[model samples]
Target: MVDYSILQKKYLVGTYVNRGLTFIAGEGVHLKDATGAAYLDLMSNYGVAIFGHGHPAVVERLTDQVRTLTTLHGSFANDRRAEAARRLTVRCGGGLARVFFSNSGSEANEAALKFAVLATGRRRFVACRRGYHGKTLGALSATDGRKFREAFEPLIWDVVFVPYGDIGALEAAVDDATAGFIVEPILGEGGIIVPETGYLKLASEICRARGALLLVDEVQTGAGRTGPFLASESEGIAYDILTLGKGLAGGIPFGATLVSRDVGERIPRSSHTSTFGGNPLAAAGVLAALDLLDEPMADHVRKVGAYFMAGLEAIGSGEIAAVRGRGLMIGVEVRSRRDDILKKLQDEKILAIPAAENVVRFLPPYVIRESHIDDALAKLAGILSGLSAGSPPPCAAS
Candidate 1:
């Protein structure tokens, strides 16, 4: 048989950091390799498989939808798609009345930006520096950072950048010409920086007063990843535009852009549409996901998340500069050699991901419990201890 990794490197674009590890299957929160070895999954496929891999409800729902109907164009109405949209809009609340489905988080943001432009009749926008929306041209325009934007110079939209978690900068950047201000609730890719309380409220008020739409990108913080169904919910601010993706469809590639009735009415027909958006299979998964991610699971997330974070904070290692995040979305800023520490975790079969430049981000499955936290914490402590003693991870020869 051909080596999957080799074939990928040979035939596919080399844009991702190939971990040189492949999994054949997943059950619950663990992924099994070809050799039948299981690795603890902490990152949940970059926060996509929030309910965990192959959950019975998600699988069963997708299977049923596949047998019945899978794809249908948006021009026609379908049962599953309609139910999914109705439930999503109700759950998202905050005066959002309509949903535009898409295939990924980038597509969701792309729709949000376009709707903002059409509703407000403005071209300029405000985005947080070091924030990540997506790589598509329109989404890329809102995503700040030279790393993601340097090659795609002279981005299509006019956007000004401001520091994340800074209300003063946000206020100064947004003006009458600003159509929208898009931001992540917890600043996920910006090192999981949890802005102080009242930041969202103040930003919402400023946007409304200035007549600029407040676009909340919950692509990472939504679906109970950060305690509530949306990190924006707790702030009690009615966002003009909201985007949801990364596991909203029970592992199906799905995205939804919700807008207030006022904004939705302004969005003229044929302005934006997607072929694969709201396919029956993905819609079924969304329904199943919504059913499973109920109030009890939300409570569980709050309990387990606090437990995990407390354990991480208790690890008194000088190498760890800080630990910050909400619910299952967590990050540890290390003093140095963050990648080396991540390698050490991977060497021990504990999977995680990176955020910003110095943060070791952990977007663990909500199914994680105290036992899992204990295991990861033990491994983390041991690795930090080894680093302090001038010993690195097994393969950290670099």
Candidate 2:
């Protein structure tokens, strides 16, 4: 047998902390490693596999499209692309009239920022502290994280950062020159921090009163991850722009920026275009995702998510500082040894990811059942109990 990890370390850029496991197959919410070990996936590849891996609908649609026509420039209209865009816009209806397709979430936020500048004719923007937009230059400017931004100094245009969930700070940050304010409905990468109730609605009002556009970054919280098509929808706010990615295309590389009619009109022709922006393959995946991510599936996510959160809270371990999130996007804020806990979970045939400094974030697939949650909670309880009893973690030294 070949050791893929050694080859990857030698050839690929060392950007990611490899978990030393190679997944060869995935079905439903379970992933099988090269050695045929089954592992329950709670991270969902950072919230991408909403329908779980190799969902029948997504596989069937993608299979048909791949055989037909895969790649086509955005300048040409394709049947699948047109249908996908129409359905997506209608589903996100809050005066949203258009969508600009891209390859990733970072590109979606980048386009939204540029469109905001064009629509409002201002280069300044506002963002929230602990908010994660993306790593691209334009998006990074609005992402308030010193770790990601410190290396790339003097990023894009003028961007002001303010405390999240604080209406006063957000309102004070926006002024005459502020074109827009970008924020995540839930801070996924920043540790699954959910904002206060009506925070988005109040921010929308502030942006409108100040002649600035509101851009809701739903990249992590969208596509049924948070028990809603868009997390901002629950807030009853009509934002000027909304960004979506991750599982919007059922594991394909896809991003979309939905804009209001007014904001859409401000974007001129040829201002932005992508070669594989609206590829037929990705469009088919989007259609499949839209069909499966119905109201019933969303309700399932809510019910199962609440049950999972309650289970975690019931553990009542001293190592856990808090358990917070909405829908399936949960975070277990550990007082310390977050990485050690993640490693232990891996050892127990489960996979999870870390966020911020001390959060064991769980972006489980919507298809995750109560039994899966129970299994994960059981393992977590054992790990936390061991930690609380002064037992050294399995991978503490590493």
Candidate 3:
């Protein structure tokens, strides 16, 4: 067996409690560890691997772009960056006509915040409780997790946290003095809690009425993860500022905050920028990702998502609490043994993520096959049956 414990102990940051699987390679929707053991990738690298690992289209574009131009500051114009911005705006399918590129979801959100301040001239912004934007100072201020934000108190003074899905609370929070309201259409990292249909529309109306902008953070739920180009688009809501990441480059680091033409006209050019933002290599990958995500693949995700949800429901027993989420983003709530169940699933060669509400999150890549879903269900059923009988999960790590 390949030994990695010493390397992990020496170099890895201990902030994240890893699952102990050292993936050495991947193709399509499956990953192989150093020991050659295989696992079906259901977590999708926390929703980054939208098209799965090592997709041919993305790989080819990245290879070609590296030879041509890999790193350049955003000051100069590049063909790939221009094409990527055009493709993104065309896909947005609304009045959103301008794009600001960044390297990660956090930076994308930070750009949106800066745009909000520039457009509204207000310092205050509002976000929902338990909503996660990102970890940067500005984005972290917008995120609502106490555990993540507690250490950094005094984030941004004007930032406010309100109950998600509560129109009244959102309305009360946003006033004429507010800069913008940032929200996740579907709470992705907060356990796949999709709000009611009109919740977003109502929030947008409130923000507009109060002279504040609405910014939708689709970082985790965008780019076919939710059967649409973006979760906000699926809900039939348009925002003044929209952020996209996670799946933008099919696992490559790429993020964008699109500003409506009206919002774009208000901001100056030098107000915000990133050194590696919209670099040619990442741009080529983004362009290829956009091209590959056509209508047929999106339709497949919708059908397969329904099928997967049904399978999970059919396996439900008293030990299972609830199943929720939309498209391919699913969450399974259990009455007990959440951690133990996750370890058991790992041992059974299935990958899943733990949610804040004791829920198991399944964010499989868009390329996951029907057979993969079936195998995941069967393995999960075996684990659940064993756990329900009061037997401790045998594979749980110390």
Candidate 4:
């Protein structure tokens, strides 16, 4: 039998941290590995599999498009592409009048930054500390954190960093020369931090008062991840720009940056174009995602997410420091040895990912039920107890 892992390590770039399991298939909420063992997927591949893996509707939509026409440049109008863009604009309807499609979250941020620069004719931006936009140069400039930006010193543009959730700091940061303020509705990579109530509304107001575009990066919280198409919708402020990706297209590589009519009009013709940005195949996935992302499904996410958090809080383990997040994008902050805890959970066949330094992040698919939550809680409780008892974590540190 071929050791695909070894082959991949030998040939592929060694950038990503491997978890030592090669999944062969996924169904519903479980990923089956090469050994035919199934593991409960709580991370949802960083929140991309909202309806879980290989959902029939998603597969059918993608399969149908694949068979018909897969690739058509943006110069030509494709049915799925047109429909996806139309629906996206309508769904993100607070002055978001148009859409620019891309192939990933990073590309979405890239387009948002460029459009902001074009619309306002300013090269300066304001971003929150600990926020992550993407690794691409344009996006990286707005992303805070020395680790992501230090190696690439002197980013694409000048960006000011302010404290996350601090309205006063934001007021001091935005000026007339600022093109836009790029921020996540909730900080995802920064340990699932939820801002104080009405924070986004106040931030939007500050941006507007200073003539800066409010660029909301909903790449992690959009597509109903936080119980709505866009998490910032709850603030009721008319956002000038918004970005979406990661499960926006039913597990397909897709992204969208929605802009207000004013901003869209300012963008020059043929300024930015991606070959596979809105191809029929990815568009089909977007339509399928929109179809499945309805009001009831959103309500389910809110309710079940509360239940999951409640379970975590009830565990009352000494190892747990806090549990925080909105909807399914949750995190359990541990006091110490975060990697050992993650490896222990992996040994128990329950999968989760890490964020920040000590946060165990869980971005489970929307298909998760109370049963799944209970199972995860049970395993986590056992793991925490074993650690508290000074038992060796089952494997080497991740």
- lDDT against the true structure, per candidate, is 0.92, 0.92, 0.88, 0.92
lDDT of 1 by residue, 150-244 (tens): 99899998999999889989988888999999988889888999888888889999999999999999999998998889998979988699999
Candidate 1 has a TM-score of 0.97
What tens-digit string does per-residue lDDT give for candidate 3 at 360-379? 99999998888999999999
Pairs in clash, predicted candidate 3: none
Candidate 2 residue-wise lDDT, 1-398, digit = tens? 88988998999999899898888899899999887889999988999998899999899999999999999988889999999999999999888999999989999999999999889989999998888988989999999878899999989799999988899998889898899989998898888898888999999999999999999999999888889888888787776999999989989999999999999989999888888897999999999999999999999999999999999999999899999999999999999999999999999998999999999999999999999999999999999999888856658957
Candidate with more favorable, higher TM-score: 2 or 3: 2
- For residue 114, what is the lDDT in candidate 1? 98
Cα RMSD of all models vs. native, in order, equals: 2.8, 2.7, 3.3, 3.1
lDDT score of residue 215 within candidate 1: 92
- TM-scores, one per candidate: 0.97, 0.97, 0.96, 0.97
Q: Clashing pairs in model 2?
A: none
Clashes of each: 0, 0, 0, 0
True-structure lDDT of candidate 4: 0.92
Stretches > 4 Å off in candidate 1: 391-398
lDDT of 4 by residue, 1-398 (tens): 88888888899999889888888899899999888899999999999999999999999999998999999999999899999999989988898899999999999999999999999999999999989999999999888888788988988889999999999999999999999999998999988999988998998899888889999999999989989878888899887889998998888899899999999999998998899999899999999999999999999999999999999999999899999988999999999999999999999999999998999999999999999999999999999998888845548446
